[model samples]
Target: MTAHSDSPPSSSSRRRTAKKKRSSTPSTKEGMPSRSPRALSTSLESIQINPRTPKTPRSNDRRWPREDDVDEVELSLLGEDERRQAADGMGLEEEMDYVSQPPKKSVSSKDKSAIVLLVILYLIQGFPLGLALGSVPFLLREHLSYSQLAIFSLASYPYSLKLLWSPIVDSYFFRSIGRRKSWILPMQLVIGTVMLLISFRAEEYMNHPAEHIYEISLAFTGLVTFSATQDIAVDGWALTLLSEENLSYASTCQTIGLNTGFFASFTVFLAFNSESFAHKWGIPRLTLGTYLQFCSLFSFGVTIWLLFKKEDKETSEEDINIKTVYKTMWNICKLKHVQILCLMHLLAKIAWAANDAATQLKMVEKGLGREDLAIAVLIDFPFQILGGYVAGRWSRGDKPLRPWMIAFGPRLVLALVATLTVFWFPKPPITIAFFAFLVIQTVLSSFAGTIQFGGIASFHTRISDPVVGGTYMTLLATFTNLGGTWPRFFVLKGVDAFSIATCNIKAAGQQLSVKAAECVSEHGKQACKDLGGECITERDGYYIVSAICMGVGTLLVVFYLIPTARKLQALPASKWRVYT
Candidate 1:
């Protein structure tokens, strides 16, 4: 028995001896066992109380190792100066976490080229729009009644509804040449071909406009439809071609380019076709067909150049499918900011719509010829350009849209000026004082408009997610266009509601017998007398509409716009992301 006990006898006895040895052994001072004295004591107490119980450390008594303690040890290894340097380095890393890095260098050459290309393409896009909205109405004014002209404006519906097919453009892209190029090249080719064909037929259509009005209108509608479709591709291309840092300037390019093209098609092209200008300048006269052909040739040149330019080919793997496109669009539309933006866009130009619709007629009533109107446009053009440039500069860097709110005061003042001008000068013999006032108003209004539009465009570009850029951008533009277009219906209806007659002198003459007594009974005799025998009728509709629009616009800016802009500004970049 003595020999057995001495020779580490049974397994149970050996286990007890091992436990005792482990409990007695001094644990390393650096480990948790040394630091947690309670855990060590608890183990010894539990072992003495019940040897049958398996010996285990008390988890409750064991303390976790502290980061500060570890850090202190690390610091102890270094000298005092080295420890101070390490602490400074750590602070610097923390500081960098919160600090914004400096902006990158100026835009690269490749990006500049892309911006130039975008501007040119946007110019092309604006051409058809200008011709349709500006020149066509002016050209057809003599033949078509005001109501008829308003009806004819329905041809621009394609522009406001292009979002219906924007997803298709975004989802499926040609892998060969490029996604945007494939669409742009083909659409440009088709549009140019159609314009060329129209050029050949334009003179004939103009000659018998009363007879071929429907056909001519249909042709123009087709042109607008194709132009709007191509716009989608170009807009998407702009989103992809430019980096986020340069996106805001995309609006500047668009505004300047679009306005330039508009000036060309609306003012310059119309001036070239003006009979008075042609006669006065002794310039060779050209038919509308010639102008159309010029535009067509320009389109073809642009298309050919774009065809040769290399674009980044999008892969099928990266492209969103149609279903995904719809899903993303739905998701985007659901955003709170997006909803507010859409509403703001829809209401932004409501204040100017009536003034715009009635201004031409008012000018005519005031004995201002078409040339006078054209001159006003020319005076306003430079200011428009300057406004766009200034706004672009102000909206650069970190906050591209914050400065836009400054335009509200100027815009409100302009709206008031417009209202007063309409009521103040609505008669013949436009005096020099009145003319100067009109010119000043036009210049200031144009400048303010350019700035407001530039800011809105930049905001749209900034918020649009690149994954579904075409659809998103188009939706924003569509709402904006609708705001400009839909209000015209109300304006025209208001004109009629306010008893503004569409004077038909010939019809009145037919109704009147040779006797002066018959003239008293003519249907439009009173309106003729009011207009001083001019072919227009007017009333106080302009003042009423202007007052209503201005009031509503002011209210919206105060309540809706200020708050929404504040909210948008408060959001961080992380919150701006919609897709994963």
Candidate 2:
């Protein structure tokens, strides 16, 4: 019996010894449960954390159980937790040593080529792709019996809603030249070929003049279509070239290029055609076709030149293709700032078109013939060019205030001056009032145009949403067209068909006055009498309406754009994403 009792006590001592052995040398898997003391040590070690208190793990229920002696405790299932706590207790420097190294510089021959290609493509994009659209007003009035509204309206249609097809352009590649290049090359070639073809048939079509308006419109539609497409690709190309560091210079260059193209096409081309004494008169009917063909050929040639220059370069960002472009465009359209500007765009353009519809009519109301109007317009070209240059400089300048003043201040002041001049000087002294109005209108219009285009370009650059830049710009173009063209077409359908005098002579009793004056001053006396004799004439009510509309439109644009410009100025330039 004594032997049995001794054996039982010995066995109990052995079991205690085994337990002690297990607790002394714990494996990492078994060391996780005793977490409290280690956590306390960690809290003390970390300088960033509060040394006096342990962090609460969301709730009391989730808290580590309060133990009597964590160092002495041997937990069954909490081994992993204790190990993690121990690992965390190591010095931060050791932890940081486990972090990854920074990336190396990546430059290649291809990257260099890409930069060159981008700039060249952008520069080439500035030529006259759709000059015919600008000439539509004159084209219809000269060749077809169609009213100004119909021609402008039809011509504007292709551009007015180009956004609808922009997604397709952004998504699908033409299976030959890649996505952007595919559309660009073919369209360029087509524009050139079609312009050349149209040049041959220009006079035939004009002379036949049936419901041939549709045929002419069809031709214009093709031009506008390709032009809008080109704009999309070019815009995308521009955005791709821009970076935080060089965005200002890049944007300014783009703006200059665009305006240069616009002015060259509108002014320089006209001048080339205008040398009548050299037996090369730019008579619209004879020269329009050839000029367009030349422009188209030049534009296409440049695009092809870029094709050769950029063949080796590929976009490094996997997201540079059509799918990404569409996605980016979608996202940008949803942005609040973009939405606001778009709305303002629609509103401002409507007012602009309303006021613009009567400019030529107003001149006619002052007894000025078409030849006289043409001469006045010719003289005003330089002022317009100067205004464009000023606008470019102001927009590119650092000061928000100067740009705002150049854009809206000049526009509003000119509108007021023009209004006063017209109302106060209808028939004064050898067409003095007429010339004054012309000068003011020309200067103001040019300055206003500069502001409008530059401001829009700048705004477009700043709104760096992660949408396709090209598609976003196309939307801007589409909206601008909607704003500028639609309202004018709808409101002034018949009004622009006849000059102010021809339309209102019967209504105002000026027809009888003209016949009565035919015997006295012949044409001279009739001109004076039609000027409302000594009283201020109300013949140019349309122009007054237009000037007021312009003044109001200027106000609207200024209010909308100035705040945006200020906000853009406030943000760090580095934060801007050139490709939104």
lDDT agreement with native, every candidate:
0.59, 0.45
Estimate, for each residue in 1-580, the C-alpha lDDT of model 1 and write its tens digit: 0000000112332233234323422223331212111100000000000001111221132332235435655765777667667767877452232233356569988789988998888677667767776776666654444445556667666766666676666544445556577678888888888889988878676655656767777877887788767766775566447654554454455555666676677777777777777888999765678888888898899988886798863222122345655675678788777887778777777667666666665555445655566677878766655775676676665566665677778878877777666566656656778778888988876676666655665665566553344446556656766766677657755654554434433454464222121121122344455544433334445566777777887887788776777677666644544553
Score every model by TM-score: 0.67, 0.56
Best candidate per lDDT, number? 1
Candidate 1: segments with Cα more than 4 A from true spot: 1-120, 201-214, 238-257, 304-312, 316-319, 389-409, 419-434, 454-474, 500-544, 551-580
In angstroms, the error of model 2 at 405 is 7.9
Clash list (residue pairs), candidate 1: none
Error of 2 at 156 (Å): 3.5
Query: Which candidate achieves the best TM-score against the true structure?
Result: 1
Error of 1 at 530 (Å): 18
